[model samples]
Target: MQQLSKSHIPFFVVLVLCFTPWLQSPSALVLGLILSQLGWVPTNVPIAKWTKKLLSYSIIGLGFGISLSEAFKATSSGIGLIVTTIFVTLILGTWIAIKIGLDKKTGYLISSGTAICGGSAIAAVSPAINANANQTGLALAVVFILNSVALFVFPVIGHALNLDQHTFGVWAAIAIHDTSSVVGAAGAYGEEALRTATTLKLARALWIIPVALGSAWYFGKGKQKLQIPTFIFLYIAAVVVSDLLPQFETLYHMTFSVAKQTLVACLFLIGSAISLEQVKEAGLKPLLFGVGLWLAISIGTLVWLLY
Candidate 1:
């Protein structure tokens, strides 16, 4: 029998890391990076091939985790703030990207990520806007890296300001770029904050459908007509099945738990794929554009939460 390849160790590490949220995903990313440098995994691995499929499946499974009633309540109460923030961030973020010399597609992709749910928003909007792989990768990289930062930083900011749990939850949900970061930051602050932020973030995620369509229309992809992602429908199905079968709450919870774990693995695979070329391709322009939108939502939501 052949001895086990030592290279499998980091791969195993990545496998373990993938089940976590942005809070832990960042660590996976950093470790993946270091392991890649050490030759534990080749930098040329085709991570995107499997990652896209797993990402969609994990998202669909995420529905099993969100109660429809809870999501609806969050939507009803936070819809105004969610809608306004998304719209403003998209328009302003796109404009900034253009002014800073990024392409229109990259600009729109980053804006969608920043305005909505980071990597998910960019993934959802990419097909509609006809974004190429490099464009989507750049957008995802920026949002993913910042999401890692936000996971740790937002909680510190919330505590420093002496904000209450409810206020911090809403602020995090409205401000942070990704659900995991929003949830992670708030979870650090308080349990109630976690519940509130998760509900609001899930509710905010529903905007992906409309935003995807809108990008298609505004960018001329509407000529091919709209095509919704099946994961979106599957996600809805997961929510319905979870709610209607309350007796299976135990099972649904289990399903969601597995899904979160899959997301952790997914992040690991994605993190391993980043390279110096991609970094050069991303450049400072998109980073600055993303930072602008990130700062905008962070400060803007805090102000709204306060008054």
Candidate 2:
């Protein structure tokens, strides 16, 4: 068996710290980025796959902390906004990409990421469009950079605008690309915001199926199988189980708490995957397109929420 190297020790240590209360989402992300820059991330570990699994499990565990009635109300009230924003973001993103002369696949990937669930949207659409590694990597780099920024900036913007928890949650769900960042920002804001954001974001994520199928038809890759996130059904089931069995509320809360910490660790892994070379490879045009699309959605959503 291969032995653990001394160079890998720091990465393991920080990862463990991520599970503790001392390391929150933003800090964990920052630490991960630092690790990546320092070349401390272990090559043997499959960080991307691990991040995906941990995030899915954490999200499902979070369902235990939420009331199903509240989840329903949040989803129902924001259904119109979610649908509108998804379509609008895609259309606007396409336009911006064309104007900026961004690559079609890369542009669409960024737009899909912004319009839907960030990395998840990009991942689902990439295969449908038959995007090459460079194209997919560029798209993911843009979205990931923006997602990291949103984690820190959105909460500050919420406080500055004096937006209530519901408004902030909706804004985060719509504006942020990745579910992890949305949960991170909303969780920092308050419990109500976290619940609202989590429910709305997952509900929005359900659009991935139709969107992916549509992309395949549009891109003439009809044979591509869509990568649907099955965890969402499990998340819904968790909510149902939690609501129905109030007697096990304590156990549910414990699971939820553990899941939240796991999410922090997942963020760390996500951060460690982001290398300076990856950012450099993302290039200027695609990055600009991502930023512009993100700003349009973020500002537009915040204005609608405030008004």
Per-residue lDDT, model 2, residue 218, is: 68
Residue-pair clash count for candidate 1: 6
Deviation from native of the Cα of residue 167 in model 2, angstroms: 7.6
Point out where model 1 deviates above 4 Å: 1-13, 16-23, 31-46, 103-106, 123-137, 148-165, 187-195, 213-223
Superposed on all Cα atoms, the candidates' RMSDs to the truth, in angstroms, are 4.2, 5.5
Model 2 clashing residue pairs (backbone): none
Off by over 4 Å in 2: 1-3, 94-221, 224-229, 284-287, 302-307
Number of backbone-clashing residue pairs for each candidate, in the order shown:
6, 0
lDDT of all predictions: 0.77, 0.80
lDDT of 1: 0.77
For candidate 2, report its TM-score: 0.65
